[model samples]
Target: MTRRHFRLLIPVFLVAILGGVVWFQLRSPSAETIAAWVDQAEIALSNQQWKESERLAQLIADSGDREAAQLIAGETAYFEGNLESAFQTLGQIPLESRWRPRASLLAGYAAFRLQQPYLAEQLLTEAIESYPKEVDAFRVLSVIHYDQGNLRVAIEDLQQVATLAPEDARPWRQLGLIHRDFERFPEAEQAYAQAVQRKLPPVLEAEVRQEWADVLVRLARHPEAEAILDAIPPEVPMTAERMTTALAIAQVTQSPEQLDAQLAQAVKQFPRHAPILRANGVRALQRNDPESAVKWLKTATQVDPYDYRNYYELAQAYQRANNATAAKEAESEVKRLQALLTRLTELSEAAMDQPWDAAVRRELATLCRSLGKMELAKQWEIAASRCEQAR
Candidate 1:
């Protein structure tokens, strides 16, 4: 209770108050600082820098902005193909939060990717309720309906997306794919034409053109398809499908010399490509060179035994070479492969009808593997895994 003790206590109180102020300043980030961090995170996300965006999201989370942080984290995970983590993180964002609409859309997309079509449909419906003009939601909903075999509903959803984003070619491209898969060649050609008219990245434009050309070929518009194919830039890398399409067009529309030159180029570029090898063999057979035809046809069969067309062509080459027994054996092989291909088509239709059936998807993977479609086999395997998880 002395005057000196009172004076020491006052300084102690002042030091304690000053320390509290400093601690508060250190603990709470300014609103402007948080906004800046958010901007940087979004920029990183737009640029596809997933790790950097996640790091910034963590910083934002530490600063007590959990919703924005969650959205950033979810988006990064989604872009990185971590759909489960994306769905969980995005679903945690509250409906009242400013980030809710975007979160819901992404979460719905994640669910769809995970093969939970029913849940994804509900979530997307909710998101569209919140953001009526959500093009991405509508686009994904179209895909979900397509997978579920609701073709009419899928087209309706895609039309809505196309209406919402008139300048985007992706919706039309999707429409084209749907029609193409159903063998509606005219509708596919029209949709692909629309897609090609819109703005697209160069690579995507080339791909779209290629797809359009394929549809044109199916429609027997050989001249138009050849013109479209010729318009594509030479620098674009030719995928197997692209080369196959080119060969198909060349065989029908080009002179024999031109067809031969194109086949040579294709065979040089893809020495082990089964389709090109078969085309070469067929050309040789047409020229009455049975020995060369037999050699190329045998190579084609070895390269891809599952393609019944190769076996059929080999049978023809064997007959031309007067090998009756070999021709009969090749014919039998063709019949067996054609039966397998028919079964594959039937199973694919079954899969589209029963989206929740993991067994159908697993069978598809097995069949695709047996047919030498390793990439498609992997995709079917992944789809089966996702289907199982959804169940």
Candidate 2:
């Protein structure tokens, strides 16, 4: 209402307007400033500062450079476990761009995680074609083929990866795994040998050595297998599977006294271990100590009531000890189990007529052993070995 008050408010308004103008000028950075931001974003990405990289990438995109920003954003999404977003973002990169190969690889990986195998294969194939030396692309493609049950193709892809990265032992180790799964023991042995020669990390070397020894065992090179097993460092914790394998190797290579010592140690460590108990019972029977056999076999049966082999072995022990009533009871249990095994026996017999049916033969061998027919079990085991050799 007064002229003096109006004049004072006008000066205040002018000062506020000048401050606003300065703030706007500072907010809108120059082109050189944005370029520096982009460089910093790239550096952040290289250093795996995901949050800062993503924020700077968004700023770059807002400043009108979208391609690099999108690439970083896509990769960040992937590392953050946003598969769908990563796929969508990476898929938007133009095919002719230099970053398209990387985009395709990331998109392929996202598709694989999303369970879209066909799309993954398509994208990965494109990436590999565009970037032939990309070892990761080949590795993922091999995994896909392996999962799809195309073993030969998987092996070929892994072989290419090995050629591409000769100093990397992973491809050779993976090849050994595939060969071992197919029962191609000699091929597995060679692959594992290559991995070992390449000098892998300690954990991986131990793993490869264990698998190589297993292959040797399958090939009936028990002495070499035992040597390999013995060389495993004592520091490596013994897993149940490794313990079982060690027991088997000992049974084949060690004298009775040595075997007894190993069995005692195993039983002490694993009190409820049915296999060790069964092995002890068998060892007693071999020494013509039927009473000891009965004690061990009874404990084995109690530990693993479902294993018909224990019952059958118990019957033999009772008969040897002249316990007619106990032998009859155990024999009755064997008959019951035999009835349950009849259908499996029929299937195995049918498979026997087919060429190279190792799985069925092995199953039949196990079943026959439980039936107390060692002769038949041995024959089936031999057939299974022949089938494995053929593979």
Best by lDDT: 1
TM-score of 1: 0.69
> Candidate 2 lDDT, tens digit per residue, 1-391?
7999999899899999999989767776676766677568657865778778878877877765576668778877887789999999999999987668878988999988886665787899999887899887888888766544345667888999999989989889999997887679999999988988886766667777888888888998889887876777888776555565677788899998998898888878777888778878988998999999999999998887757788899999999999999999998987788785775547454553553567877877787777656886787776577557545
Q: 1-391 in candidate 1: lDDT tens per residue?
A: 9999999899999999999989978888988888788779878987898788878888998988888888888888887889999999999999898778778888999998887877798889888988889888898888777655456678889889989999888889988988898889998999999998898887888888889999999988988998987888888877777887899898898899999998999999999999899989999999999999999999999998888899899999999999999999999999887777888889878876776678988998898888888987887787677667676
TM-score of candidate 2 to 2 decimals: 0.58
Q: Which ten residues in a row have the lowest lDDT in candidate 2?
A: 347-356
- Candidate 1 Cα outliers beyond 4 Å, as residue runs: 1-118, 129-132, 142-156, 235-241
lDDT of 2: 0.80
